[model samples]
Target: MSTATQSSGTGTGTGTATADAADLAPVRTESLAAILVAGERPPRPNALQASLTFGWRAILKIKHVPEQLFDVTAFPIMMVLMYTYLFGGALAGSPEEYIQYLLPGILVMSVVMITMYTGVSVNIDIAKGVFDRFRSLPIWRPSTLVGYLLGDALRYTIASVVMLAVGLIMGFRPAGGVQGVVAGVVLLIVFSFAFSWVWTMFGLLLRTEKSVMGMSMMILFPLTFLSDIFVRPETMPGWLQAFVNNNPVTHLASAVRGLMDGSWPTTEIAWSLGWAGVLVAVFGPITMRLYNRK
Candidate 1:
């Protein structure tokens, strides 16, 4: 079950969106449908095409609900205020100082939260016979399943940009300049889309949308708190520090922090991207499995 990979590169910094071709060597049989008519077989539909169909439908669904825009717009402001004025003095130095540190974390946090909504919406559609309609269509094995996630990546982009704008308005500035800020937000949305594959898998397997919401959150809660999302991981116990050190969210947060500070690091980006690839590898197939079951 493969979806499209997008590449983004700037003048000096060129990032290729190359899938590990070796990984695509064989696909799971469940990622296909078996059809026989008088000992004849049907040619398989391309998964990318199916995924894009899901993407287009999700975009259309978003248009129907104008309130979808409010999530990212309101969520960031509330989180910034709750974390800054409420806990800034105790956690960091001051509200202003903490925001300087907090903005990047919140940027990624917004992406994380936005992905939850994706799971919710997907589960809702699944429960309400949307997937039934989709199943009747000759869609790709994982395209509709994976494309739903890709569509939400656009929402993640909006959520990240909206939060960044709100942070700036509240005196949260990225010292890393415009390009750094762009890179930080881009990686965050990409990472969120990758992590969202976990939620997508759960949503595909779960029966109820509400259960999907709870279970999806149960999985992410530890990932959010145990990482460097709200507080410094260095402050954790030595045993926990090892976990935090290895957390992809921590690497993502640290990389964003580096970009915001206009500092360069060679390794954190790899750690973050590696985590994204891992999530996609593990959960992408699971989503395909559940999607086929439907």
Candidate 2:
């Protein structure tokens, strides 16, 4: 019995010692590498792919926090209703007649106003340090900024569509038919996209979201309100008319209004396109520089 017990104890001790020796063995670089990367690494995403990825991320954020859509939906609905009824009778003698003139302008105003939120989003992301991780990635740099604009473009579209629905309900008819209406909306969205770059630059330059918002409102209020949206620039004082006439918003509003009315205002369209190009050319570089430094 003693001999059998001794043998059993010896076997157990040897097995335990062997297990520990294996555990303490140094891991080889090859083995470690194999374990760390189980397969071939993925290729770095190209600019378009990267940009689209970030854009999708923005959309996902909206999906998770759907309340972000309130500005696009509720605010637009309110603006259309309040302005159509409030100004309709006073401005054009009747609500129905006024809607025909007001809807396109209102559409431009609402979408342009919401473009400021792109800067707000950039500021928020910077605050949360989300951008830090983005910087460390191997993707295209401008993709992040472009992604925000693309996502906000969707919001612009939503606001435009909602406002149009409300306008139609309010008796705003576009003489340009569906084709003209579509063209007008497309032009507005393009301008809004270009305009968003301004806000993006502000977002990079400003330390806080509120600061960006305040600056945007200060600039936008004058541009939108002083233009031919609510009243004709000809009715304003001479000096004020000069500013209103040159305002990019005025050109955008005029272009959109003309398109929707089937008038095809070539001068307005050219001016609007020129302004859009100028915005992207000027602000886009500044924004990218700020983004890289920030």
Candidate 3:
């Protein structure tokens, strides 16, 4: 009887100790549950970091679909070859002279053309419901677009280099030396980056990638060809000259020309920068609004 009582007392004491410990210990609340109860959000990445993260994601996409670079690589090469051989003699009296003029214009057109891909990509993502997941994440919304634009910097640079290299191989020499060439490339990239906003807005507004590409092409074609890209506007009618002079593509091409030729025309550079700012101002907000709405 004594041993039985001692055993029972010890068991009861252990149970009491356990109960006290349980009561004294921090409540076994899940961190998530506690966070939810507190109505607190976990800290998210800052704008720059978030944008870079998204940018990295965009770069990674190239691994899975290397063909995504076809426009940047093959298309630029074909354009360079076809344009130099086909129109070089007729436009500037020889292939050599024409390439110097044509190369800069081609670079501008290529960059503008590729900006549409941004819209197409965004549209496809939206269609696939991938954006739905992104929307749910604790990220700065604008970072996604900024990230894509940053990621595409590589594509723009590659296209520019290819055009320049092809032009050089074909006897197109720049008077601007190394410094001039570097400046021209930098300016081209800046313009291209700003121009991408217009396409991003299109992506937000368009229903499908095809529609974005088609619509963008329709708009860009006129902007590129109607300017003084292939031929001088002086030969055209007065009204056509007026339009060409005012064309933004004309200013960009002229800026590129001056840089490559070592002339560095401040007026054209100012105009190109102004237009880039205008495009970003107009399209950036629109794209963000549409994205947030989605």
Candidate 4:
């Protein structure tokens, strides 16, 4: 009886010690409110800041996928070489002479053609659901589309520089010299920036990237080839000349060609700028509406 009673007393003591140890140990219970509201929230970024941030993101994407630059580099080089050589002999009696007329037009064509990629990019982003997150962000609604155009502006510059370098090497000289060339390039970039809004709208409307590309090509091919990029529009039929005369691309080429040739094409420049403004005014709002709805 005494031994049994001693064993019972020991067991009771062990249980008491375990309970005391547990009580001494730290018991951290985090409050749900305190954890969530730890500190003041950061200030929201303004429109320009958010837009530029997204533009930087687009630049970083090019850095990671350097192949994205092939359109700006190889495509322009090939165009300069192929057209300058092929038409130089047959049309102008020499590649050297033809390049003088062809380079500016080709520069305009190449840059404009590549602008379709903007829509393709938008479609891909939408397909991946990335824009959904962008829409949810506290940012200016149009900033996302603006950021895309800003990024593409760099690509446009790259293509222009590459083509100009090729032209210089191929005996193409600009009478307008440095100032004229700079003005022409600036004008092209501005026009391209406005033109890209059309593609952005298409991107939002189209279901697939391929569909966007197809639609862009269907529209671009006629606009580019029907213009005076390859030959004098006067040589064509009167009906064709009428279409070519009214083509915005023709006016842009004329303006750029005149600038590079050291002549101020005031009328052509005005028309080009007017067309650019019209494109942006019409398509920018449409794109934003689609973007908001999408």
Candidate 5:
């Protein structure tokens, strides 16, 4: 009897210790089903999160699609030579004059053109239901959209440098030196960023990637070619000239050339940036509105 009592008491003590440990362990108040359901809620991105995520995605996409390098690395170089040597004499007085005037315009157009493809990628994701999957992530809702915006910045910078290198190779030196060149690039990039918001809205609004790409051509081509990319607006017809004169792209390109050639036009620069600011004011809200609805 005494032996049995001692054994029973030991078993009781062990059971009590085990119960205490169970009570002290971290508790998950929510069930697995509840946690899983919570994950289905859409993520909302903030500004910082959007930038970082976009930057990462942009870089990774670069890794997977090395073909993108052709655009930034090769196309601009060929374009510079094509416009400066082949078409220069026909369009302008001489190659040197054409190079000086055409450099800034081409640079601005390149960045703008590269960014217009954002809608294609976005619409592709939307069509594939990737965005809906994002909506299910617990991530910040704004992050997905904001990240896309930041991701494109890397390509913009790369494209800018490639074009500048090509221009340098062609004997087109900026009179204002490095600082002027940097300022010119900065102005164009700001303009590109402002322009991207409008495209981004299209991405959210469109149905298929192809449709968005087609619409992109409609918007991008008119904005770029109709500007003073190759020929001066003065050579254009009176009514057509009015439209070119008022074009924001023309003002931005002119300001870039002015800065680079040491013919800094403060009024043009201010007006160009004013245009960028105005675009931001108008489209930024529209993008957010569409993003939320998505």
Candidate 6:
């Protein structure tokens, strides 16, 4: 008899073969159907741990591309040195006096400027298709941005230290003792962290890394130079002075200068913190929304 006909019989070998085929058919069909229907869900990660993992990943990226740090390390030092020597005499009577006054302002400006890089980096990652991989992973959705912010904190710290060290070498002194310097540093880090959310939002909205960088400079220049970073706002036209007086950068600089000078900075500190809160409240949700949509 033919093998096909034999396999269909109820006798010993044929019975076993028929039974095996029956068992295997359903399994194969079900498995294929399951695959076509839906994939198994990946396990979710703990929110905090996932975010830190992302943060560590960002830190590791710098090892492979150390030039990523040029802005945080080199530019701030250049700004402190060049501005002190070039504009010190013209703006603050002498470079010596300007070093003291301008150092605090430069410190603030440097950290704030560094915030732009956060946006550029975010945009680059999105453009490179890395964010799509992140989306496919089972981690918390916001963890990627949170981790990036954490990594950028390291950048902010390095920039702050570089600015302070360069200032001291150039004869800048803080009248506020150790306690005051610490407070100023804490405030600077906090403000920079919050300001980063603004850039993060811009990164999500913009199409290209170059556009993000260009727009960031456009926004930051008015906020920094138009305020009191290099010169007294009062020296400007009255209309300009009015805007400077209300500028958030003005409050941040005033707060930093006050802390370093051992002066009470109740109003400035309050305003600085308020601006930080406002930036977080407004931009943070928008960034997350755009990220989810993208």
Q: TM-score winner among the candidates?
A: 2
Clashing pairs in 3: none
lDDT pick, better of 1 and 3: 3
**Order of candidate numbers by lDDT, starting with the best:** 4, 2, 6, 3, 5, 1
Query: Please, what are the lDDT tens digits per residue for candidate 2 over residues 240-277?
Result: 99999999999999999999999999999999999999
Rank candidates by TM-score, best first.
Answer: 2, 4, 3, 6, 5, 1
Candidate 6 lDDT tens digits, 68-182:
8898889998898899999888877899999888988999998998888888889999999999999998888999998888899898888888888888888988999778888
Candidate 5 lDDT over 1-294, as tens digits, reads 999999999999999999999998875767756777877655566557656976698679888998967877787787788889887788877898689888888998888887876667777778888888877776667677667767777788899998888888787879989889989888888888788888888998988877788888898899899998878898999999999999988999889988898878998899899998998899888977887788
- lDDT, residue 165, model 1: 79
C-alpha lDDT of all candidate models, in order:
0.78, 0.93, 0.89, 0.94, 0.83, 0.90
Off by over 4 Å in 3: 1-43
Error of 3 at 163 (Å): 1.0
Displacement of the residue 14 alpha carbon in candidate 1, Å: 81
**Best of the candidates, lDDT:** 4
Listed in order, each prediction's TM-score against the native is 0.80, 0.93, 0.86, 0.89, 0.81, 0.84
Question: How high a TM-score does candidate 5 get?
Answer: 0.81
Model 2 lDDT, residue 90, Cα: 87
RMSD versus native structure for model 3:
6.0
Candidate 4, position 55, lDDT = 85
**For model 5, the run of ten residues with the poorest summed lDDT:** 41-50
Q: Which stretches of candidate 6 lie over 4 Å from their true place?
A: 1-44
lDDT of 2: 0.93
Quick one: how many clashes does candidate 4 have? Answer: 0
Model 4 lDDT tens row, 50-150: 88988888888889999999999999999999998988999899999999999999999999999999999999999999999998998888888889998
Per-residue lDDT, model 1, residue 126, is 79
